[model samples]
Target chain A: MKPSDKAPSEKALVPFVSVDHMMQLIHHIGVEEMMSGIAGYIEDDFHRWELFDKTPRVASHSEVGVIELMPTSDGEMYGFKYVNGHPKNTKEGLQTVTAFGLLANVETGYPMLLSEMTMLTALRTAATSAMVAKHLAPKGADTMAMIGNGAQSEFQTLAMKAICGLKSVRLYDIDLAATEKCAANLAAQDIKVVICKTPEEAIEGAQILTTCTADKQNATILSDNMVGSGVHINAIGGDCPGKTELAAGILQRSDIFVEYPPQTRIEGEIQQLPEDYPVTELWQVITGTAAGRTSERQITLFDSVGFAIEDFSALRYVRDQLEATGLYHALDLLADPDDPRDLFGMLQRAAPGNA
Target chain B: MKPSDKAPSEKALVPFVSVDHMMQLIHHIGVEEMMSGIAGYIEDDFHRWELFDKTPRVASHSEVGVIELMPTSDGEMYGFKYVNGHPKNTKEGLQTVTAFGLLANVETGYPMLLSEMTMLTALRTAATSAMVAKHLAPKGADTMAMIGNGAQSEFQTLAMKAICGLKSVRLYDIDLAATEKCAANLAAQDIKVVICKTPEEAIEGAQILTTCTADKQNATILSDNMVGSGVHINAIGGDCPGKTELAAGILQRSDIFVEYPPQTRIEGEIQQLPEDYPVTELWQVITGTAAGRTSERQITLFDSVGFAIEDFSALRYVRDQLEATGLYHALDLLADPDDPRDLFGMLQRAAPGNA
Candidate 1:
């Protein structure tokens, strides 16, 4: 339908999905199921990677943090996310990160969906981690160590359990309360939860080591000495410059895979390494163009600093789900005038005195 | 407060405002009055120009059109506008341009307001034109020749009358129906509407000449022969590369003014001039740091391409007005959690069988 086709009495509006609605969707579908669906979407898009128009996020940095806009499109649909990173936010009783996004139809250049992405980001990030683990982790992997239990920990644990089939999780965090809270929250789940005293203790005998520390520094949570053979590392934190989880020696010994090499080279754990260092984009593995987990004895690392395209996939998935469920609220985000040229007339029609 | 504190309960919530709400606000407050108020805000911000952190807009250009993000801040408040330009859109019954924006408190980096700017853009553009005319146009300029009557023409004409005190308007458009529609809309108002056959006839004896045509190419709407001494030219349509209104000869003869010279040099009529061509920024004129209309007989030109700060001002004004009148509905745009670390719990709370 054209923008000008609407009669004065007809109102064609955009739809908005609130955070509450998104949470309801997740709860109803189950986080595990949601992550699996999102993972499938990401994998489907990754296989057709060349169709996208990609760019490094545009960032505005300040002393305490950075705010950025990440936009990507595939000719027909355009999506963008507004996100901020402020590591000190936790100390101030705020989140270190929060985000929202919009998905628009490129044909009309009109916003079709506006969504709360903060929760979705957590879900997508965990789902992405599991997608990497599926390809990079050794077969029949069961035990996993989660270093740095924070707000994102439970989601990661559940996604791994649901998507990667992990059965046991050992948790460690510098903040004991955070780890305790995480353990308490997951107590009823089928999987085992171990509150380890130290990072070494947490990693011992684990087939997968996931590092998601919130420290805004190059703290080596996983030393080279602690990692064993045939381990898969899902490195989620150390996503900004000067923040890293693994020691340089660990990277040297592992097969490092990344999401969007250009961005990961600047923001991921590999930021500590030289630009020419070897790395592989995960899409290659998903598309079967490159080998993943070459041998059971090899260490595989997925250094993921979130990318825009994944958000695009998540937006599309959420929009589709919301439409199918008929749970979203409609919003007048774009103007749909009776006569497209007479936008001012909308004001006149809505005028209290005139009506 | 903290993003973490707000993360869990409202992890994926974003508030939205529809075009209806925007029109509601405009109708509640008379359009003439809103234009006057916006012009005041634009003038106030322009006077304190140095306080703003300004940058040239970031744009992604495709063969069909261009999409751009314009961001600016004044240490305390930050704002950005997402806009697109596709001259061919009207033929497909879509707006030539559409926009939306957000205003955030810089100290907290929390978005305070989100708005649909398609309608607001037309209002702000008109307010900006009138703001420039207030400083550069000759005193008591009653008649304005508005070339290219389209979606933007009505707002421009109304704002000129309300903010710049123009009593009569002469309308001309390539599509006679568009000009006829614009004249018909203004017939109820106090101002006299004159429909002219040609640009020359429209420009005859008019004190201010406004060129707001929708063409995306370099089409000269005004030539040196049509413009006489002392007449003020509000060049509005020629805002992108290869699009211009005044002939190079006209620009050479007039005392030109612009908004952000670096951007105007690329998008404004001055794009045709040399890199070293002398021009005064409108902010300088607003602040009284530069001369405007040096003599009643000296021609002055306000080469308006529209700018981000004006939108910032307009957003702040609309938000404040909405809040004061209780006309704005609260949006759950940001996620607010009871316990920030319990983001995963939110999903469990929303689980299938849970209330």
Candidate 2:
């Protein structure tokens, strides 16, 4: 065959992991193993967080929801995720969150991987929570009180079990159907599950509490009186301005740990508190620059607003694993001319069959 | 088939236009006709520019080049282009710029169209230049001196011919092979083509002068003595910082027009000019809020660094044409579960083949 009829040149193709491939990849490594692996990558990035470019995510807010582009680079590789959060979408049979990401070579400015990140985002968020829990959760913490059991419930449970050796989870949500779905999905896993009706009953004996709800308003999912001392709280639902979950009293009681102070101050649970509220950076704890969980009586809360570096690390991990698993399709995404300056000639040659 | 084994739901798919399909679509519509059509869309957008969400492109600069995300919305639809610029890439047989864009439903936050935009960017950039020229060029202008016969040279010439009724083009480049390739590509066009060795010889007797060199430095392709009165100059090559084509004397004498002043001040040819340098917004001219080409002896320079709104307009045009042409493939880019909050269940069901 002539060169024109041959498959696209290597430089013209970007490796794309579709939703199917992403699912296949998750299963290939096993869900628990994948969660553990992703946590390891997040930990490595956290140790070297100072090397990354850290800017607040660029967001465009609409009346109903918000769309954002989170970008970060490590000097060698660049990555970005295009994501949206519309909490009302689930009522219309659409996801409240959807995402896709790209990883490019910084030297050449050419994309190396493009992947469906809806599923990956769930996995990475869970991994990050579990990794942070490992560093801050109370000693011998095995049972997690997973309030607001929605799409992220099972993944969070599995990641906690895989990374922090959690043995059981108590789930509660305003909608019992969501809790039922979470329970049914985790039936085959190696952890015990408890379905509870009230938020107070869910955290009865658990030492770790993870709250991730889908409400766009500032309704209190966790009340101040419900949270006790010596338990680590992983708060993931309060991720945008004017959409927080924990009560202001709870934030005042707990020693908060955040990804980035600037972002957390605006979008995390601390948005309700003063702008200059003191919070410790998670990377500082990981890198041994700050103390973490100094005593069993101390109340520690990880205000988990996702960051760009976490996405960058997730993309980096996927890029490293893509070639080994072969669970990707090469997309003809770039236009490459024989002579880099002859794009017009390339179009001229493609004119024959079009007529 | 069982419901679990069925194909993905329609909401899970995004229409993707690959490089080959983009080429076919361009050929299906004649090149000049497509250029004119894009110019029409751009003109329409320029007239309604106040309705757009305008923001400076978010760029991550590396030592070698830069990667940028340009995003905009018209309240109903949102679009963004992922583009990279590495001038040193040409030596390695890669195009200096490669781009891809997605048009999304603003209400749903779901992508409706994903398209390869390397070729589309070329077409849109040329169409923008021509559209600007139609508003600012000398009356009855028929000839254009096309400096730097790179990937963008022929497209610019043809766009000028298609949109402004140009009759001929004079092409010159530091590399003769680029000029030869551009000349050969435009051989079948309706416009007269002239090849020249020197920039001075090429601009002779031309009413419109276009300069789009590829160097990263401020090398003056047109000296002070070269540019004359009443000629419309389309300056595109000097897009990034520290890159310029015309001498400062040329910019000092011309009535400069720019897409967005905030961006043009940092990345366009005006980067060399003072921070408070006066330049007209092109949209203002189109909207008749500002005057364009007031005097016959006045030299008008279009400082074209490109803008996110132009890409938004281009994506809107492609989205409008997508269904009619039927040249796109549906990509499984998003995860859509029957129950929006049952993502864990979806992963558990895809486990059969992974083992």
* DockQ score of the complex predicted as candidate 1: 0.49
Docking class of 1: medium
Best by TM-score: 2
| Stretches of model 2 off by over 4 angstroms after superposition | A353-355, B1-6, B353-355
Per-model CA lDDT versus the true structure: 0.83, 0.91
lDDT per residue (tens digit) for residues B1-355 in model 2: 2365336789999999998898888888888898899889999988889888888999999888999999998888889999999999999999899999998888889989999999999999999999999999999999999999999999999999999999999999999998998898888887899999899999999999999998888889899899999999999999988888889999999999999999999999899899999999999999999999998899999999989888888888887888899989999999988888988888777776533
Q: Which digits, one per residue and each the tens of the lDDT, describe model 2 over residues A1-355?
A: 1356334678999999999899999888988898888889889999999999888999888998988999999999999999999998999999999999999999988999999999999999999999999999999999999998888999999999999999999999999999999999998897899999999999999999999998888979889999899999999999999888899999998899999999999899999998888999999999999999999988899999999988888888888888799999999999888778888877776666533
- For each candidate, the DockQ is 0.49, 0.85
| CAPRI tier for the interface of model 2 | high
